[model samples]
Target: MHDPGSSEHNNRIPKPLGEAFLSLLERDQRRMLRICTRLESIADGLPGSGKLRRTAREIAFLDRAFDRHMFIHEKFLFPLVRSLCDSRESVEPMLCQLEAEHATDQGLILEITAAYAGAIGSTPRAVGVPLCTLGYLLRAFFENFRRHAAWEKMLLHPVVKDQFISETPKHQHDAVLRYSIGAGRSGRWFPAVVG
Candidate 1:
């Protein structure tokens, strides 16, 4: 495969643009994992549906942060790499896989959310739906997503960054916005949750 950002290549992204974007995206992912891990630990022990309900609500509150983080990547980062990439053979498939994973992740989250909601509310057990299903879905999502995110960061990020840096940074338009939690703003950088 052609190396876009290698010293032997001309298509390398401007180092600052690629690294800057990659760093913040990584940060957002790490923070989100921390939150999710904490929530998982909360729900992992004991057998109380009430605890599940509370945990669901807590996770729901932070769902937007996760959605927004993915949105920015899908909407901005991947497209740039796709269009500018020289070795489409190598990276395009990966980007497509990433996008597909994004969709899969969305579906998994919805399933998890529904299962949690079912566990929380006074639903009919006569329908044969077990509350244990919720626990299963919750655990599945965390286990799966952790590996997926880690793969993206480890394998995909460097390649994308190299491609992004090869291009002249000024001409491209990325709708970059930070995800601030409180009295702050994302502005030109990636999103941040302050709270």
Candidate 2:
């Protein structure tokens, strides 16, 4: 096991893929934080009945951010980490847990969107539901993201660097860059690539 606190660990340089992945994660985290701040401000105003449309638009933006996170983890990050690990025994469980969390988050987003839409369509009863849902979802979203980011920065990143130095080829490094920086260019929006 790597000692996360040691000076050696602190001095270690991340592999290209690991660095790119961290950069993407950091960028998205900042973006989400900004969005959350705006949402909090909006929530403070009590968001009158007339503002349902705007609230719905904000919820849609949240959905987009959440979806981008899922794409990165499910499509790129998790797979690469799993492939490089010696045993799936431990990592698989964490991946499963994280994926389940993603599913729950997506479900909450759908619920909130539906409520927001209903409210916008003039059903006053539906308005409160989205506000309550967003409150819960935001808490879960931020907590999960914070924990995951710390774990990656403290544990997985160093391990990935060690593994990459030991096993990866030059072409694989280039491939990592392409996947991290170049994938999903046209209509598909990547949170990291977007802002």
Candidate 3:
């Protein structure tokens, strides 16, 4: 068994499948950051900037991307972590907490979508509560999401890296397919290459 805290384990690269999983997650997060920056600018210029339509569109995109990202975590990453770590007692709490956060995020997204759905026209007053709520909601989601992603990366990556370090390439590929395709049931969304 690999000692997760050992310096050697910390320095080792994750096995190919684990590395690929982390890379996909990191890519999604970077994309999210770009969208968050864009949303922040829109929020800064809110209320009467005639960006209502654009805000709606951006929020929609964020909603979809965020939903998919969270699905990958809840369905794939968390379970994989649970199976990989010998000390489930150490990791289970974090997974549960993150899952709760995912629920909260979904609720927030619904509220945001509802707010923007009713919002119409370019005037500040016409936009009403949505105009008032939009900036705060966007900030809340983006801030929480950024923190959550960073926390997950910090806590989980080391375990994944250490656990897979000694796994053979064939074993790695089979494991990836087992978790990411057969069990995750999300192969359509993110197809795993058998090779």
Q: TM-score winner among the candidates?
A: 3
Colliding pairs, model 3: none
State every prediction's TM-score relative to the real structure: 0.68, 0.61, 0.73
Q: Cα deviation in Å at residue 151, candidate 3?
A: 1.1
Can you rank all candidates by TM-score, best first? 3, 1, 2
RMSD of each: 12.4, 11.1, 10.2
Q: Which stretches of candidate 1 lie over 4 Å from their true place?
A: 1-16, 49-54, 122-129, 164-195
Against the unseen true structure, what C-alpha lDDT does each candidate score?
A: 0.63, 0.61, 0.71
Task: Answer with 1 or 3, whichever has the higher lDDT.
Answer: 3
Q: Which whole-number lDDT from 0 to 100 does residue 67 have in model 2?
A: 88
Clashes of each: 13, 0, 0
Q: For residues 1-195, what per-residue lDDT tens digits would candidate 2 score against the true structure?
A: 789999998998765655566678668767766766656555555545325566667777989998897787788776665555657576777777767777876776676566555545556656445555455554555555556556655765565566556545664574454445543313232332321
- TM-score quality measure for candidate 2: 0.61
- The Cα error of candidate 3 at residue 119, in Å, is 3.0
The regions of model 2 sitting more than 4 angstroms off are: 1-15, 49-54, 122-195
